[model samples]
Structure formats: structure tokens, C-alpha cells
Target chain A: MGKLKVLSVGALSTIQDEGRFGYRQFGIPQSGAMDISAMQNANHLVSNNPEWPVIETAIQGMKLEAIDETIISVTGAVVTLKINEHQVPMNASHQLQQGDILTISKPMGGVYFYLGIGGQLRANKDFGSYSTYIMAGFGGMEGRALKKGDILETQGGKPFKKHVIKQGTKPSMTETIRIMKGPEWKLLKDLPERTIFQVDPSSNRMGIRLIGDPLGIDGKEILSSAVIPGTIQLPPNGIPIVLMNDCQTTGGYPRIGKVVNEDMGRLSQLNPMHKLRLKIIPLEEALEKR
Target chain B: MNILKEKELPLLQFNKVSWDLFRLGEQSLLLQAPFDIPIEKIHDSAKLIKSVLGSLLTDIVPSYNSIALFHSFEESTIIEKLSTARGISQKKSTPIQKVEIPICYELGLDLEHVAEHSGISQDEVIDIHLNDTYRAILIGFTPGFIYMDGLDERLACPRKANPRKYLEFGSIGIGGEQTGIYSLASPGGWNIIGRTPLHLFDYKKQPPMSVEVGSEVSYVRITKQEFESWGS
Candidate 1:
């Protein structure tokens, strides 16, 4: 099997993986791959199953076509690749064939971007997650995002042996990032010495609202609980947000800081207004390299 | 119990009871109960801290006065089975569980804005929302939404100051004193009034959410032609 079709589905694209686990106690939204280390290094450069199911995309640009001889690759952000029309390489692994095509484009400093594709991109999983939780439509493909034409079958593989992602092992769009303390870091107070912040263009995949410097309150609201995906809440106009990968397994703002899962893949390749800083560190060096 | 700020914490001494944990990163953990237990013993201490962190758990979550968990503290016997995770249930049981929910009160599009803002009378706002029986305190903000807890403090309101860009996947609402069930519509602001044909979240079931945090839903009302021939 090996279909792929689409032809333009850019401004979004979906699929994702390494998410949806045990169902976040059912309020759902684990929805995976907001750069889970550039989709596990583009499924370790197409060897696949580093949590399989790739394609994410989103910073505009993704065109597809390849109906067979497959084996793709295109790791995270910093885009601009192509295929039938030429220009390739982004993170390595290629083969294309069948009707060829490919493309990618829009994504300068990052916004999701994985691709991967060696076998099984299949679709429709929902609770078990095929990712694509576009505001809870369901999970991948039919669950929204990946528009223009939408074909995407996959079970392809065959064209093998090729891997890349090497130079310093890629991961630098850093604006400083690190973080830790959350559990309402004793109500934040003057903490801004290195906090900078900014990133809010209404952010999505559930959270990431950041705006900077307001933080320092004793408003005392708490109550709501259990949040995830790199927490960092703080909202009461002190503006902080940050949760991601479809956030909302439960929350009530006021988390304070969390980010460190290796800077949540550079905070999922930032973008809006950009500029960051945080730093903080220490919850065991932010779980050091769990 | 009341452990706050905590430094290198993790040593609650379990069943000998001394809870209040924290350290929500690197495998997660949040537990909280320095006092006032009974929420069915905080869901029986979140299912006995997931059977004392069995197989180093993976998720427990149980909110409304806390539970959280999400394992893998690189297992050094998980802080010795989380200082004994309170023997799973020191008696005093009552985990709740009822659930019924059929609703549709003429599709309650806010039932006349909750009877002209609770001055009461859309049949007394469906008789004070069928005389209470709620309690599902927090299934979270979306995905089988839930959030319940009684609600009839004179049918309290306060949420839709402009929030309905859609609202229609099993609707059922109310805001302030809580009440829920949008399950998966997308945009919201609560106050919906009526609409439940079950499926609180069937992503092919198996705990695909159907009321949990402490269950006991209730509702029943039915009518828009039995909410269009509802089923399962």
C-alpha cells in the first residue's frame, strides 16, 4: 500500500505520534509530537517507529504526491525542500518515485515539522492517537488539518538505507529556554531577572501564550489541577501560559514554570513575536536527560 | 501532610500516612492531602497511588483536591512504592458512580437564558436542573468535559459573556457552581442548558470517558424526540 496524494495541505498538515497515552485520564489532549525531539529525529531518519506516524508540518508548506517507492525524511522546522521540481535534503533520506512531487516550504525558525514516512502513516486512531487533535476534531486526517486534496495512505517503506540528522545533532533555535519550579513556584513574585518571555500570537496546539514581565502576584486562585506538556501556567493577567501538545488535561492557571523536557524541543520551535529567556533550571536540572 | 516549597522532598512514609507529595517533573507526582480527606478518600488515594506505583505506574490523575502521579522516577522502587501509597483505601469508601444523563430539554439552548437568568420558570429552569445529583468534579476542560458538582445555588449562572461559536456535541451546561458535558464541541463558555444523548466521549470506549472523577451524573430529561432516537 503506499498512497500519499494531498498536493498542498500546508498551513497545517497533521498525523503526529508518540502521544495519546493511557488517555490522560480521558479529558484527552495528549495529541503528541509537538517536536518530540523533531519527531524522534524524523523517526531516526526514516528507520521508523520511534513512535511512528509522522507528517506534522505546520508553518505552512507541505505538498506531497509520492504514491510508491517511498522512504521520506524532513525533520523539524527550518523548512524549504522540494522533490520532483528538484531541491531536496533538509534532514536527509529520500527516494520518492511513483508520481514524485514533495515540497515543504514555510517554516523558518520552526513550528512543528517532522514528515518521517517510511511505512505506516495510516490514520484514524483517536484514543490510541494518530495525533492531529486539531482542537479535538478526533485524531489525525479526519480529525482535521491536512487539507488540500488529502489522500495519505502509507504502508510503503521498501526504499531504505539513508539517514542524516548529524551536524551537532540539530536543535538550536534557542532563545534561552530551560525552566523548572512550577507547583506555583511560591507565587512568582519578582522572578523576572532572566525571564524575558514574549511568544504570544495566540499560540495553539492548545497553549503557549507568553507575553512577559507581568508575573508576580498573590492572587490566590489555584483549585483546578493536573496539567501537562511542560506546564508553566501563571494566568491572572500576569500572562504566562506555555503548556502545549494540545494542552488541557486539566488546569486553573498558576503553574509557574516547567519547560525542561530538554527545552520542550526548543519550546516547539517558537515563532510569534519570539524572544524568550526563562533559564531557572534545578528540578534535578529539569529532570536532566530523563 | 501540609508539605509546601519542599526541597528534595519525596519521602512521605506511605501507609504510615503522611502524604502531600510533589515533584511533578521527571516522571511526575503531585498527591496532596495534608488534611480534609474524604472525596471518597481522594478517590481512594488515587487508586492507592495506582496500586503503589505498580509497574511504576504511568498515569493516575484524579483531580478535585489532587492525585497526579504519571510515573517513571527511574524506579528506585519509586521512592519505595511512594512511601507506601496509603494501603490503597483506609476503609471509609464511597467512590460514587451513578451516571445516567439523557437530557435534551427541548434542546435547552440555554433554556430561555436559564429562565431569564434564574428569576426562574422555564419550568423552574427544568426544576432547578432536575433537583441536583451532580458530582463529577473535573473530568477537565474538554474531552468528555464533565466538571460537575451540584449547582443549584438558586441556579447560579455567570459564564457566557459571549462564548458560543458553536456548542453542540451533547451540550448540557451551567457555569459558576459548575455543571458540564460538552464532551467535544470546541468553542464554549458553558451555560448551554440542555443536550445529552450520552457518548460523553466514546473514542471507541474502554474508558474513553463517560464520567469519572467521582461519577454520579444523573440528568435523564429526554425529548427532542428522545434526542433523535439516541443510543448507547
Candidate 2:
């Protein structure tokens, strides 16, 4: 019954969980947390289940006033954390007394950050998930982004005292992400021997629009087919679009590459205008790394 | 085999990704399918390949014309299964169930617009629309929103220049040679001619989806009174 009421929702905030899976055949996009690893780490820090619901914020952080005493942790995008005006570490769990105000600022490095509570966040669930799907107008706080003065409830349970902080290596923000050739790769005539497309400003959860030389292609319309979260589709415009968690279940655009499952986390955290180099890797090598 | 030879079904080839498996992230693999074909045939092929791969492998997603196989195994057994499955000949098509949906032309908000644009009477528009059975070519754009083909060519109409702010759930609309029903309220450019009471998507249902790939859908025209009486 414990909860954390929102005093002021920061610049960008949304409720997210692991994701809703196995329903793509129905055309529902898998809307979930953008940074899967960060969400997991944040949950681990609070000893909550790895897939428990958490709040994801963009560059600017959120401010919350605790309704009840509880333990929480922040992870991803290196944001400055404070509890009642006292500075706190981003990756460690801390107890907040009721009425204590927590403020977080924009990230020093990354574009996204996560706040993990010890228990589940109170939000309406749709299709067995609490993640927001703004396009469908369902889930989360009225199926849209969190605004200021929104109250968030959580099932406050006893916090685990023994926090196992498994520090993992953070991916370099500047690293070029590799992608395997897409199904329609052969259709492209003048593809760079080494492909690296920069992310465009128009990118969001729906998909990442890339800025690159038009990939020359054999004239043909690819049949509409199933698209996964990491699919890289090339529309007739010739610019490749990398689909994300909120992407459609199927599409007709030509696919030139698919980001390996392991690299999607990295791509999810990429800011606008970030450059990503696409190196072709063997499926075996990619799987081995996983 | 004799039927295949007589039908002249094109032989589909399976080619493996020559370069490294493109990594989308830590948990997914994108297996490429050959491109270049009619949209319907590509969809058919993707559905066929999806069924084959779904039956042969575990924990893989067959996305639009591509297969995204997921695995937690350290040994890459999933890759082996995919490669082996890809090497085989095309599998037989599985039978898909047919769903009959009832639509009330009176409930269509843009029926007059459709009639006026096509230079036909409202009655003529309805007549042309109800004359043919539509096939579900694919399911996309939104959950349970089926992409149907086989609209009467005479009734073909382009999508609206500007998308409507909100299309009522169950609204049936035509865009070009395709006509589909909206499973949920969404912004759309399609010319909505009518609406149905049937629920195409329900979260509590066992399968969750009312229609599936390859399902044949036929529309039954009902009167506004009949729709209201049926509690549509």
C-alpha cells in the first residue's frame, strides 16, 4: 500500500516494465523499457525482481515526494541524485522517509535514466503489462507520458538489506553499433562496403530514422512481413529506419539489416544525432558474444 | 508433388546471412528473407516460412518476412535449428479459420464522401463493397487490425489527404484496393464507410486475437436498427 507521489515529473518520464511479449502476431508492438540492462540493474540494486516496473526518465530527471518510507535506486545515464537536498549516488539503494523530496537532474553522459522502487509501481496494466503504449491509448498513466503532479503508487514491501551491486561494464556512448545484413540487403546496389548511418533528430521510441546516403536499390516493393523490435527497414525513401520497442508488429518496407538482440540495449540509449557504424558480423559470432 | 508440378509453384530458395548475424541487442537475431516480389506473395511466403520455423524451432519470432530467433543458450543451438529449417523445401500451408464480421453501412461516417468521390450512389457503394469476400493479407498497423485484400476494384478509393483525428473502434474503411476494420480507435487516413460491433481484439480471450494470418473474412451488411438491436 506504500506509494511515491509525484511532486513534479521531470522533463520526460514514463512507466515501463520488461515488456509485453508473444502478442506480436496480433500486431501489438512490444512497448517496454528502452534500456533493458539499466532497468535490470536498477531493480537489482533494490533487490526487486529484475522485471518489476520502474520509471524511465530522459535527460532531465524527475522529482518525487515519498508517501511512505521505502528503498529505491537510480541507474543509467549518470544523473545526479539528491534526497532532501543531500547528494546521493546514482547506483546505490537508499531509504527515503515519508515527506522526503527526491530530485534528479539531467544525465551527465547518457540520454536516459531509470528509477527502481523496491516493489511494483502502481499503474493500470494492459495485456499483462503496465508499460505505456501512447499510440494505442492504453496502459501507464492514461496511455501517455507522465506530466507534473501525477501520483504513482507502489506495493511497498520490506526492502532487502543485502544489496548485491553487480557492477557491469557500461557501453561507450560513442561506439558504432553493428548490424547484420537485412533480408533486403541484396536489393541495395551501392551500399557502402562499410556501413555506418548516423541517427537522425526525428528518432523516438517508435523507430530510429537514420541519416545516410540513399542506399541505391533494385526497383521493387518488398512484401509486407513481420518486423521485430530490432529490425532495420529501408523504405522507398532509401533511408534505413531501425524499429524499436514501440514499432509495428509487421511492415512492408525493405529490410537491409537487423540489429543483433544484444546490441538493441545500446541502440535504445543512443541520443539524437549520434553516429552508429554498422559492421557486418556472423550470426555465430554475435550469438557467442551473447 | 504432382499438384506442385501442375500448379508451377515457384521454387523458393533459402540463403543464409553471409556476414555476421546482425546484433539488434542482447536477446534477438534477425534472419533475412529474400526480397523482391508481389506484396501478397511476399506476405504468403513469410507466413509459410513463419509456420515452418515456428514448428521447427523454439523461442524465435518470425517478423514480417524475416525471422527473429531468440536464444539464451550459450551453444547456439537455435542458429543450427534455423539453418537446418531454412535448408528444407517449402512446407505445406496450414488451414486458417474464416471469420464473418457484420458491418452496418449506416454507421459509416464517410459513406456520403465515398459515394460522392467515386461518383456513385450510397446504395451502389454498399453494393459494390459487399459483393466480394476479402482475404486477410496481413495483420499490422495496430493490434488486431487486419490488412485485407480483394476489394472490388470499382470501389477503390485512396486514403484521406489528412488523417482523421480519431476513428471509432470497429470502423470499416476502404483505402485503394484494400478494406479493413479498425480493431481499436486510432488516427487513420482511410475512408471509413461503416462500423461493426464485433470485437477483433480482446485481452481476456484465450487466444487474445479474433483473426489471424491467412484467415478469410467476409462482411455481412446489417441495418442501423439491426445493429442497435444486436447491441452493437
Q: Quote the lDDT for A239 in model 2.
A: 79
Best by TM-score: 2
Best-fitting candidate, scored by DockQ: 2
lDDT of each: 0.74, 0.72
* DockQ of the two-chain complex in candidate 1: 0.24
| Per-residue accuracy of model 2 over A50-168 as CA lDDT, tens digit each | 88888888767678888888788888887789999799788888888889899988776666788888877778788878888888876788888888778777775555564646444
lDDT of 1 by residue, A1-290 (tens): 35778877655678888888667776776868887877878877877768877878766877878876677888777887889788987788887879999887888766767888777777887777788787768777888887778777777555587788752233434378877776667677767434677788878777788786787768757777888888878777787777887887888777776777777767777788777877776665566666
DockQ, model 2, C-alpha based: 0.32
Candidate 1: pairs in clash: B14-B83
The deviation in Å at residue A35 for candidate 2 is: 1.0
Best-fitting candidate, measured by lDDT?
1
